[model samples]
Target: MIPKHTVDRLSNRLTHLKPILSFEIVFIAVFVTLVFFTGGAAAQAPVGGGGGNTSGWETILDNLYNVLYITLQYAGLTILVLGFIVWLSARNNSQRSETGMKLTMGGAAMVVAYFGLGALVSLLEFIAG
Candidate 1:
């Protein structure tokens, strides 16, 4: 049988985590929706690449991609620097150390994902072709 105190602690942790989880779910849903709509719109639009006439939808997508790529690069760099600082400062506290490690790893993963995104897209295109 589980101890009552342990169960209580677990319940408290779950309550605190609920809002964070909900926010993550909502954020993911919105991102997916935007990407889906943008992709569908782009696909339906006719392609034009002659005599200096470009498709507006494609231009919008290219601008959006550029902005997002730049933003991610900056964000990833900030996370990496902050995570390393936190990790170095929290060496005396186990909980803080653990949190720091998680942040560091998450930041590193984001950076890696940013770098790998083009390769991933290329792989998908190759497979689809």
Candidate 2:
């Protein structure tokens, strides 16, 4: 369980961040709702040499996939390493050890989430199909 102070601190932070967070939430929510409600049938892309439908999509997908995979994996690794260092450097401090442990777990979660996203996409495709 999280401590009361941490919960209160996070609540305060979230309160301060409300406007920006609301804007981001609304921005994504509108598009996401449109996506979910708009597509009614499976559409096939045409094959062509000059600016084909799949060309732009393929490039965008490739770039996005590469960026996410590289960034997530490296960021997770960096966090995990930092957490390990923190854990070892503060071996005598129980609070620091706990913080380090949480950070390490969060890093591991991020890595797992990166790997899991592919499977999640497959699952979504199956369900949507």
What is candidate 2's lDDT per residue for 3-114, written digit by digit as tens? Answer: 9999999998888864656777999999999789867433444446455456666776878787898898899988988888887888689999988988889888888987
Per-residue lDDT tens digits of candidate 1, residues 1-129? 999999999998888874546877999999999998777765564556455456675688778878887777788888888888888998689888788788888888878888888678689779999
Candidate 1: lDDT of 89? Answer: 97
Worst 10 residues of 1 by lDDT: 44-53
Worst 10 residues of 2 by lDDT: 40-49
TM-score of 1: 0.52
Count backbone overlaps in model 2.
0
Error of 1 at 98 (Å): 1.4
lDDT of 1 at 28: 96
lDDT of 1 at 25: 92
Scored by CA lDDT, what does every candidate get? 0.80, 0.82
